[model samples]
Target: MSELAEPTVDPADWTCPAPLRDQPVVVMGHGGGGALSAELIEQVFAPAYGNATLAALTDSAVLDLGGARLAFSTDSYVVRPLFFPGGGLGDLAVNGTVNDLAMSGARPAYLSAAFVLEEGVELAVVEKVARAMGAAAEAAGVVVATGDTKVVESGHGDGVYVTTSGVGLVPAGVDIRPQRARPGDVVIVSGPIGLHGVAVMSVREGLEFGVEIASDTAPLADLVAAMLAVTPDIHVLRDPTRGGLGASLNEIARASGTGVRLSERSIPVPDAVANACGFLGLDPLYVANEGRLVAFVPPSAAEEVLAAMRAHPQGSGAAVIGECVAEHPGMVVVATGLGGTRVVDLPLGEQLPRIC
Candidate 1:
């Protein structure tokens, strides 16, 4: 038998993949809102900008301005195809920022939009996006108070990219943050998961799963308001967007220095989404969701908060999926359907990239 040739790269290196800290060039994972994304922020951005506010790492920055608290956030959308089943770039741009601000229990009021368009893109396309943005802002009760536009050379850019920045007023006595999660906090999810990621992937990959999968891209401000109406003492609120439920839970667990216990069967994963993910060999837990939120509420307020969520249109499918625990702090464990528990760790990178 011929001896195997020496491997070109070290086999030991392949055993454990390179960490984000060792990568000199920025990879797509850096933007994925997972372990890599967190590393990028902690190792690079956070150190460079060292401040108490940035250190909080909340979805929105709560600023004390003139004795009034303001929740501010910004997000960029580069989702391919621009338009997908149920929504488009404009909708994602507006709703994303609005939800971020709302996560902090804020009443979103103003938005600033910026666009970078390719030179060859048609004006009609731009107009369509603008109209969508306008309609979304209106739906969210926010205004596009200011905006800027720029056109890049045809070959130098994607069709279009939109960035939305928003500001909202945070009510007093409301202190929602990932770090607020405690052992007894009850976890709630707004609706079915994995819809948006599957919806976008189906369109982009031109795959048919025997059933239509539409993006769950809607403004969650009103739904959040409804929940707040029940109680402002909500411990934590997170919009599971890019990294999905798994990453969001991992982030919360780490931030609060608590363990998270999830019931696999309790998570609301639509049949269509489940089938699609099964066929695509993807995990529903890590799929992106544009419109859903994960909330951590104290046990005393959990019932009322969940009821309020279910009463809202956006939260009609809300469900209590898990709770925080003291065991295995900074980790997430799920009770599997097969009567076994499994650890759900943070994703190293994005599973579905270019997805808003």
Candidate 2:
């Protein structure tokens, strides 16, 4: 055989693939916890990190350290207006990370908060936020172990941005994750949805619905503990945060390769939220929630788990909204009140940005 010459390549010929290539720059959707967010992590961050733990893509990374299982998670809060109806940036920061750890069947124990403050921001504002953080940490039964502060030039940053990292211990025999969702599992939401997004929007836009909607920005570690008390075999747990219930269900379906079917009537949408969304031309399903969670439990244990959730204050509105199915794996379908079925795809981006 004749020898062949080596092929020549040009470095300038390279280009990023579709979606990301289309944008060519970071956009709000990249951080919206939607399809764009997933793509960014899968196409960019995941390959760069090249770790199996990160590949799992759970809300928190479960690590085995010194013969103990720990769940670690971090989140940043850049919510505008700083304060909202039931909570503010500080509590939101603490609760957000705590909830992420709790989703992995972990009992959150400690948190570290880092603050990025803008120059010329009032000292009283920082003090108020710090007090809120302290109170929220105490309420969640976690300590703010360590943190750092940095100041940015005026107008170069939001008044304040808080990033919180948390660690928690996962109990023995608990293995909660999205991939664990399976056909025949029952889906349940802890309570009414869309309040947090609407609450923030109402404040930001000064739009009033008939009744005031408060952000459901409470810690969910205790509620998760209560459900675990019922049974540790819970298949999956997700706190539908940035992308709301619709995005969360789609994520679970894709992760588990199972189809999720929801009942429109069964979903508990508060009247105030429904009215506000109607006025704003928004869907409640795509609105963000701070304290709510969606859980998948094996049918055999679903009733008891749901009962436990209901008995807890945070889950007083707990309802059976759906079930996982074998058909249409990796898709979510909802049965409408008018005898119709609609597919609920993962949102492309958040309807409300900087609300979390």
Candidate 3:
């Protein structure tokens, strides 16, 4: 038996896959949902778990079951500080998943909450987070029907990490997806950019502007429903979270093989956010927004959709920021204030990490 146990392993016997070869170890960017994250999903995960549903890569999986269409989505929250200016991990967990379903033109109905708690974290903090989630679910008009809990060693886990999954019903006539974006489509943003990211960064780093910037951590399901009431033919819908508006546009462009031309001056950047980004050498375009959405509508229906968005409180500050073009397919270009055009490419990594 001792002689049979003697065996050797070859150095060339082990190697990394294409996606992991370049970076042998996972980095923060992998979770930041940028270029590296795209590679991980498209190359590694997709191939490993190949399927039509996963390949589509929409915010939610729109499935046909029992003669009805259903939208399903899941997201995890690891924002630092647990509590931020306008929200905490609990509400973010609920709102993030709800928005994902809404992106598919679905009316969210139920959610499941899962928590990973650190061993030594205060029980009061957990109670507060749970309460916040209940309030957010009520506001979003969704129910937390099921839940789970787990505990990790104190050092292994942060205070708490919340993961939420949501299910919604997609109206029969509605069909929205990034691949549906077309040339001559109008690109509209729901509200100001950079608020959620900036708000979290300010508190984490103790940096401040003259005024406080609050996180826009509200639900957008109601807003989506309102827009659908006007027209169910919206080409695309996305909440610019990790990679922000810049990344969201690039993704849609790539998926649809279209070009987007943005008016830099037309994009709404709040004064507080603008000032803070400038001081910190950051681009407001690449900053994350939790409670905002970017919609692409056909030119013929743009006006009606914009009006519908405006009528909703969540989309009060909506604006037409750009248009999809046919000239340079699969690219994003911005008309700068300097009377020049520049490419607004997807970032390689995150500028601010763990904000969402």
Candidate 4:
């Protein structure tokens, strides 16, 4: 009989303490939704400001007045290459907020947008952004109930920055949160990754891939409806936008205090995106995807829900990439192609700053 191999070693034996590396500076990693991001929140934001509202960690604070639950989420868009292959800042600002609301298992119905335009920014350009916003709202089946616009000196702000706040209603008896993900749950990606980041980067850098690779920036209200229709037991829903799939998965694992095991071979990455990542020394898993979502569902319902997702246009490339586990709590590990395993920790720093 062959001898059994020794058990795998824990990462703590070698991993360094994250806080000691950076003492005072606020680096991009603090916003990357990985370990550093959590550190900043726990050390700076949560401690300096202690309140019941912020501690909930919900996408929106919930009020308990006669038992009606309302969801609110706000996001600021500062995407470079304001106009990219698949979308522009205007559409992104609207869709991004809508998706954030939907991720909370809420039906997005209202939005408030604020825009900061730089001086000398032509009126025609501003009008173009307004038109895009209207179209996006119509497509998502949401309304821009209120808005404000401001102009700043050219040197003070970027070309434009949009802050969008959204409100929605969560149906009774439905609960979805990152901390709710549990062992034996299945993980699903709505579609491919890296397309949006690569597309935006290519445009900003003037790199060509012989074919246009555009941002996958679209609202997820319809997709969410279909998903909840099939299985209302979804534990978590997140869009791996700014830090991509790697960061999102890491966050979920940490939040739920569970181990996540993913099969790298199962992830759906487009050919154009894979090529672009290779040429640019980037990992497709760490690239942003504006139009995709990650879902955590009961293992038994995974196949049925995956089929339903694949039937939708936004989730045509849907796949079951991983499952939650009990070991390695608060960490995520992936089975690489070469029969090796590595931790898919949150990125330590920004791979491409200001991409979004």
Top model number, lDDT: 2
TM for candidate 3 is: 0.94
Cand. 1 TM to true fold: 0.95
Kindly report which residue stretches of model 2 are placed more than 4 angstroms away from their true locations once superposed. 1-18
Question: Residues 264-349, candidate 4, lDDT per residue (tens digit)?
Answer: 99999999999999999999989988889999999888888899899899888899999999999989899999999988877865
Per-residue accuracy of model 2 over 161-237 as CA lDDT, tens digit each: 99999999999999999999999999999999999999999999999997788999999999999999999999999
lDDT of 1: 0.92
Q: Model 4 clash pairs?
A: none
Ranking by lDDT: 2, 1, 3, 4
Which lDDT values do the candidates have, in the order given?
Answer: 0.92, 0.93, 0.91, 0.84
Q: What is the C-alpha RMSD of each candidate to the true structure, in Å?
A: 4.8, 5.0, 4.6, 9.1
Cα displacement (Å) at residue 261, model 1: 0.2
In model 1, the worst 10-residue window by lDDT is 9-18
Q: Which stretches of candidate 3 lie over 4 Å from their true place?
A: 1-20
Tens-place lDDT per residue, model 3, 44-156, is 88889877688676889999889899999999899998998999888799999999999999999999999999999999999999999999999999999999999999799
lDDT of 3 at 47: 89
TM-score-better candidate, 1 vs 4: 1
TM-score of 2: 0.94
Q: How many backbone clashes does candidate 1 have?
A: 0
Model 1, 1-356: lDDT tens digits are 34786435543444333487555556777788888888888888888998768867789999999999999998889999899999999999999999999999999999999999999998999999999999999999999999999999989889999999999999999999999999999999999999999999999999999988999999998998899899899999999998899999999999999999999999999999999999999999999999999999999999999999998999999999998999999999999999999999999888988898
